[model samples]
Target: MAVTVLSVNAQQRGNRENMTPEKMAERMTEKMTEDLKLDEAQKQEVYDLNLESANKRTEMMAKEQTDKKAARENMKADQEAHEAKLKEILTNDQFVKWEEIQKEQREKMKDRRGGGGRPQ
Candidate 1:
């Protein structure tokens, strides 16, 4: 039973690692649609934004193999651009809720890292 559980966990992790930008965007869109009660247009726009962000992240991950600092800076810039786009696309209330969601996720990540936050 333990072996089966471990194998399933490993397989899930592998699947996540290999997920395409479209798949990631779809998942994010679905979640955001549910959380924000988004309209069809909002869902479509969010999906596009999410796909673009995912592709940028994938590219940054590749770049990180060669230049960690440069990759980090590029990632930050990309994130800021994405956030700007999101602010433009989302309603003010939705944007505030999105920020709260992001803060919650960051807190969860910090907890997962034993409260250390990101390594500098």
Candidate 2:
């Protein structure tokens, strides 16, 4: 049983390690589609947006960042632009729900990291 659990965990970790931008974008777009009930056109748009964002993120992570503040600002700008596009694509109600979902996920991540309001 212990060996089986370890294998499963290792498999999951390996999947994450092997994920490419295309695969990451597809997974993200699928989740958004399920959550927001996106139409075909919206799904395609979201997938494109996700692909672009994923590629950018992969590029950023690959580079050796020298300035932490600049990196943070860049990430913030990218996030804001992404949300702006999403707002244009999603309905107001869906946008609100998406924000709520994001908030919940952030909270979960904080908890996982043993965070007590760490500064960004």
Candidate 3:
């Protein structure tokens, strides 16, 4: 039983680590659609945005970067660009709610990482 549980957990972790951009986009779109009550058009737009963002993130992660500081700066720039696009795509209320959701996710991630500082 213990072995089975460990194997299940490992499989789940592997799935998360190997998640594709389309899968990530679909999941994010579904969550946003449910949370924001998005229209079909809005859902489609959000999905496209999410897919693009996920692709960029995957590309960044795949890079062989010797300079951690440079990688961090690049990531920060990418995040800013993504937020700007989201602001344009979402209504004012939706944007506000999205920000709140992002904050909550960040906090949860921090807790999961044992209260580590922001990722470099």
Identify the runs in model 1 with alpha carbons over 4 angstroms from their true place: 1-9
Instruction: Give the least accurate 10-residue stretch of model 2, judged by summed lDDT.
Output: 111-120
Q: Note the clash tally of each candidate.
A: 0, 0, 0
Q: Given candidate 1, what's the lDDT at residue 11? A: 100
For candidate 2, write residues 1-120 as lDDT tens digits: 999998998999899867999999999999999998999999999999999998888888788999988888888899999999999989899899999999999999889668765676
C-alpha local distance difference test of each model: 0.90, 0.91, 0.91
Candidate No. with top TM-score? 1
lDDT of 1 by residue, 2-117 (tens): 99998998999899989988898899999999988899998899999999999988776665367677777888999999999989889999999999999999999899789998
State the lDDT at 77 in candidate 1. 93
Error of 1 at 22 (Å): 0.5
Q: What is the Cα-based TM-score of model 2?
A: 0.85
The TM-score of predicted model 1 comes to 0.87
Better of 1 and 2 by lDDT: 2
